[model samples]
Target: MKHIAKVVELVESKKDDYIALANDIWSLAEMRYAEFESAERHASAIEAAGFTVTRGVAGMPTAFMAQAGRGGPVIGFLGEYDALAGLNQESGATACRPAADAANGNGHGCGHHLLGTASHLAAVVARDYFAAHGIEATVRFYGCPAEEAAAGKTFMARAGLFDDLDVALCWHPSVANSVFMNATLANVQAYFRFHGKASHAALAPHLGRSALDAAELMNIGVNYLREHMPDQARVHFAYINSGGISTNVVPAHAETLYTIRARTSPEAIDLFERVKQIAEGAALMTGTRVEMVFDKACSNVLHNDTLDAVLDRNMHAIGGMNVTANEVAFATEIQKTINPDDLANASRHFAAALRDPRPIIPEILPYRPDVERPVTGSTDVGDVSWAAPTTQCLTACYAWGTGFHSWQMVSQGKLSLAHKGMLLAAKTLAATGIDLVGQPATLRAAREELHRKRGLKPYQCPIPGDVTPPPARAAGTPAARASQDVIA
Candidate 1:
């Protein structure tokens, strides 16, 4: 607790700089592996803070690692800078509207702008505190990218980036302030492409084996396979190509993207194999060749009760955000834009943690490490958890009913409420990092917990070794500029 106060003070003294960094990332709105400017900005900030920064790590141009301190336990801070596509909304606006100069047709709907900045700030403050107090701990910031639709951290973990970490701390922008104790689904995503010979429909209908038909059959088969799968398992797909626009010509090729999820990586991988079998059956039925191209995958979170308690202590010590009347009013307006069903859905998630239905949740929720919420979503952070003893907290950065990846969330990305939440998370992480450095026994306990939870099973990268990450797109491309008019 010696450096906790000093670290909090350091974070407060540099609040303006952190806020500016978050805002700049918000404006840039870079997507996935192409976060060139956003990654550059973070590298520059940490480099200027006297940390040695490594650019373009883990086969990702946008991914980097920054380190400070000389010895002692190694503490890692996980950060993400990827923005969602098709969410080009103006910040601080109550109503849904695109920004005047929405570049690249992307927005930080998930609040990763705040996520990366706060983690960076916490690392900077914790590093400074360790150096000043002679605590002898190494602090690192992992600038992970493509967390939105791609699992960038999964690849980073595969490359032995987190092998030396004693413990890892991360935080997310959420609707409530609490420890993210529940387990998330482990998921695998891939593209199934079918190929067939093309022929004129009018002249030789029997000669052509339509790839589109095969793709449709594959989807139907998977839908039926869902019933036999475990109740918790899920399969979702979308057609990337319907072969052709013209009905007069027989389609020669078609592509579909599928995402398979389960409670664990082994389960998800087994389910993925089953789905591949369905694709092969469809190909046989239609006399078409099918190719399964692996996209990406992330493991389920290895929840650590020991580290969660440390984070909870820090969160309670830091307290909650102090919302002004005007901020509450803005949050209320944002809530009005949310659908009733979405509001009810959010309430169910918060039922255990929150009793008051305030538009802005300004209180820290009780820690519930044993509660197992149904696995519905996934994050690249899960891979980091498996790599080391990792734990993350959630801070309120939006209205109670503001669902992620929506215009409502994007509208409040740069507001004062969001900034308050970001800074509070920074303090909590900084305090937690300091605690891990000063207390070796506590850190050891956390590591032991991780080992017990994992048992004898070793960590395996879901992505195949032969596969590499997709290349970053050029700045001026049509796909980069295409926009989706998602109003809600």
Candidate 2:
């Protein structure tokens, strides 16, 4: 409470610069694990603010950590800046207008540009508040990368980066503002490669063993298995290699990426095993060799009721965002581009929480800790939740009903509405951080809640010990060319 006013005032004073930083990241549109410039911008700002910066943490070149203040309860703020590929839309446009100047055809479709800057801004404000008040506490900003497809935080957790954190705070850009209470699905991602002998299709048809056939059979098997899988469980696949374009020859090599999801880590891993067995069956039937390469895995979110309550209080205290008439009109136009089904889904989901039917959801949604909403989506934040007493909030940044990873969300990435939401999130986060610092009991309660939920067992990382993060590739290289063909 002592520095809450200062935190809000500080965020407001530097709002324009923060917005510019977010927009710069949006323009860079760097993909997962390739956000060098974006990370540098954040690190530079942190350094300028008198924080010690640690670049390339957890063996990721794009990942970094920044800290300020002396020894005390460490409050970690998570930030992400990776963009999605092929989502390059021009900012402030209502319709789908891809930016022609985009070199990699990527965009901040998920609003990580705003997510990163807001969290970073919160960290800075909190650091300043503690220093001015002579409070003994540490504030940290973690520049997490590759959260879009790769589980960057999962690797960091495995590397014990979050182990020392007393409590971690994170936020996402969304159409509604609320503390995240729903538990997301845990998931495992792996690539299945099938290798077989090659032969001319027109001549030596009997002698050839087609790997493409094996891959197709594996997909078919998985589809059939889906019927018997749990209702909330999901299995998705994409072709990474279809052997070759020539149909006249039997394709000798084929690969497919599979993402298996379930309510928990054990369930997801179990489903992954079943899928692997199906791959083996396909390989055996087609006389091909199958190799499974584990890509990444993330655990289901662990709820910390203590932290959740604090975040909810902070959000309500911060109140709702104010949208101007022109901003509302622009949001309405953006909503028009969204699918009717998505709009309907959003309406149903927020029917009880929302106060008005405006294009922008300005009001903070009521926190519902009693309700257990099933989230089919996955986030690397899930892994962080397991490592520490982590809590996340979502602020209204995009237009209501605007789907993530879509061009519509990218169109509003640099808009005033987004900037307002970003600042709101920053203030909320800063207030919450101040509370954690001033009230030691709250941090203890949060940590105890995490321990009680976790029992005596330690946090087990979902990623395998042998697996390492994929190295960043240069543009126009063979690996980059190959990556362009594959869907993550």
Candidate 3:
């Protein structure tokens, strides 16, 4: 609170440069782990702000951590720099434009480019605030990579990289402006590879054991399992490999990638184990040997009442950024593109965030603190929340009702409106960090809340014991070529 004005001024001073950073990330449009240029850009900014950089944290080449200040109750500002596949589009306009000759190239459909810059600005501003005022709390900026596949944070949590942090901060680029209260599903990703001998289908069909049959049977089992599971439990799968290209051959090798999610980590783990049983049974039914490897997993967040209270205070200070009449009309047009079911969900979500007479277009979002149930979606920040008393906010970085992982998101990430929202986030987060660092009681309360929830047990990784990252299953498989076929 002491140097908040100066801190805000610092962020303002870097405002144009910050927006440029967001645009640079948007233009780069790198995919998952391949975010080399984006990583360097963010790391360089933190370095310029007088933070020491720790490159390649959590055994990831692109992932790094930057630290400033010098004491406990270390605050972390998380950033993600991954883009979605096949979402490439030029800035502005409703029409589609790929970055190059390729039709379905990488693009920032999730607005992670904004995600990285907003939180980075928060961290840098906080550091500058401390430097100007002689504060004693340490601040960390995490340059997390590959959030698209959920790879980065899980490994960071596994490596105990976040254990020392007292609190973590994260935010996503979204259509609405608000602090979400609901918890996310605990998720686990794995691949079920079925192995068997191959033979000519036309000549010695009886001698051949088709692994494809096992994979198909596994999928059917999961589908049937849906009826028996709780309404909240989610089971999803994709046939990543289905044996030979030829129809005449009895395929010897096949695989199915699977993801299982549930309301809590324990519930998610129980469900994942049950799914493994189904996989084994399917393999037995098809005379194939089953081997499974988990790709990555994330635990559900245990929300902190203390952190949320401070976040709400800050959210009220920085009032919402209003959308123009033309933007509202644009949002209406985008709303039309959504399916009725998705449109209903988005309307319900946005309506809850706004308390106006006729949906006032959500400039400053209200913070909701009392959500008991979990949302269907999952996030790696969910893992960070379990590690420390973490709070995340959603800003209006995209148009209302704009779809995630679509051309709409990629188009709007490069818009002027998104630029405004990014600046608001930078200022708010920087002030919040200064509040915690300069004053000790709030941090104490936040830490107490974390300990109270965790008790004697430590923060646990939600992924099953054997689960691995999914990138290996499709490694060197050229998903870019596959994306081309989809768009073609």
10 residues in a row with least lDDT, candidate 1: 479-488
Which lDDT values do the candidates have, in the order given? 0.87, 0.87, 0.75
lDDT of 3 by residue, 145-246 (tens): 988866689878877878888778887777666665666777877778888779989899999888999899989888988898765789898888889799
Listed in order, each prediction's TM-score against the native is 0.96, 0.96, 0.91
Cα lDDT, model 1, residue 181: 64
Model 2 C-alpha lDDT per residue in residues 1-488, reported as the tens digit of each score: 54556777899998888999998999998988788999999999889988999999998999999998989999999999999887888878877888877767888999999999999999999988888889899999999998987888999999999998988999999888888766688999888888998999999989999999999999999989999887689999989889999999999999888999998999999999899999999999999988888888999999888998998888888789888999989998888887788886775444245535569889888888776564648888988888899988888998998888889999999999899989999999989988887778988888888888888577999887877888886532222211121111
lDDT score for residue 322 of model 3: 64
Ranking by TM-score: 1, 2, 3
lDDT, model 2 = 0.87
Q: What is the lDDT of residue 402 in candidate 3?
A: 66
Give the alpha carbon lDDT tens digit for every residue of 1-488 in model 1.
Answer: 55667877899999999999999999999988899999999999999999999999988889999999988999999999888888899888888889998876888999999999999999999988887777788999999998976888999999989978999999999888987766688999888888888999999989998999999999999989989897678899988889989898889999888999998999999999899999999999999988887888888888888998999988888888889999999998888888889887775564254555789898898886556563448988888988899989989999997898999888899999899999989999999988877788998899888888888466788877776877787532312211111110
In model 2, where do residues sit more than 4 Å from their true spots?
348-356, 474-488
lDDT of candidate 2 at residue 300, scale 0 to 100: 91
Any residue pairs clashing in model 2, and if so which?
none
